[model samples]
Target: GESVGLHLPTLSVQEGDNSIINCAYSNSASDYFIWYKQESGKGPQFIIDIRSNMDKRQGQRVTVLLNKTVKHLSLQIAATQPGDSAVYFCAEITSNTGKLIFGQGTTLQVKP
Candidate 1:
């Protein structure tokens, strides 16, 4: 069998600085992508999303970039704060199933 996916499990950043989280998806047929933030003891919250038809999308202080060519996606946060410390996950919805498949999450630790 061959490996189909991968992720970074942790990321650290200083408070008031910026953070960028990356994800690589294997399913090229996926047409939608999303970034989620989850705090301790809480469920994941949606941060931003981008469709395969688009390359980038922005929301509030967050930005999501998608590169279909390499099946790469990234989330960018500006002026990250303590409240921004959480586990971030990237999910993709495949055209075949229309169900979201989540990648291994990356924990964002904002050092105060």
Candidate 2:
């Protein structure tokens, strides 16, 4: 089964810092991965993505690293700011349907 439970509603951080958020999935057969950021009341925005065959991928200020050996995934934000405060989600694309299975998410708070 997938992770189904409550999580910390938010996280607070000072401006101009680094942030790291984490998530785990249940299916080992998942083939694609994506990271998204959702602001206060808006829908999710695509940040970065990594394929199952890749180990790491990078973008402007974000980086997504996947370790299939342990089925672990991580996102690193180079510099966190108030503008960066939002709920971050990691999703794995399942085979067959190709639907994205989203993680619980981590809310990052950037205090200015």
RMSD, one per candidate, in order = 1.9, 2.2
Sliding window of 10 residues with minimal summed lDDT for model 2: 1-10
Tens digits of per-residue lDDT for model 2, 14-104? 7888777766666788778888999989999999999988989999989998878777888889878788988988888877657878877
TM-score of each: 0.93, 0.88
The lDDT per prediction is 0.87, 0.80
Per-residue lDDT of candidate 1, residues 1-112 (tens digit): 1112435789899999999999998878889988889999999998899999999998999999998999899999999999999999898888878788888789999999
lDDT, candidate 2, at 94: 72
Candidate 1, poorest ten consecutive residues by summed lDDT? 1-10
In model 1, what is the error at residue 111, expressed in angstroms? Answer: 0.7
Runs with alpha carbons beyond 4 Å of true place in candidate 2: 2-9
Which candidate tops TM-score? 1
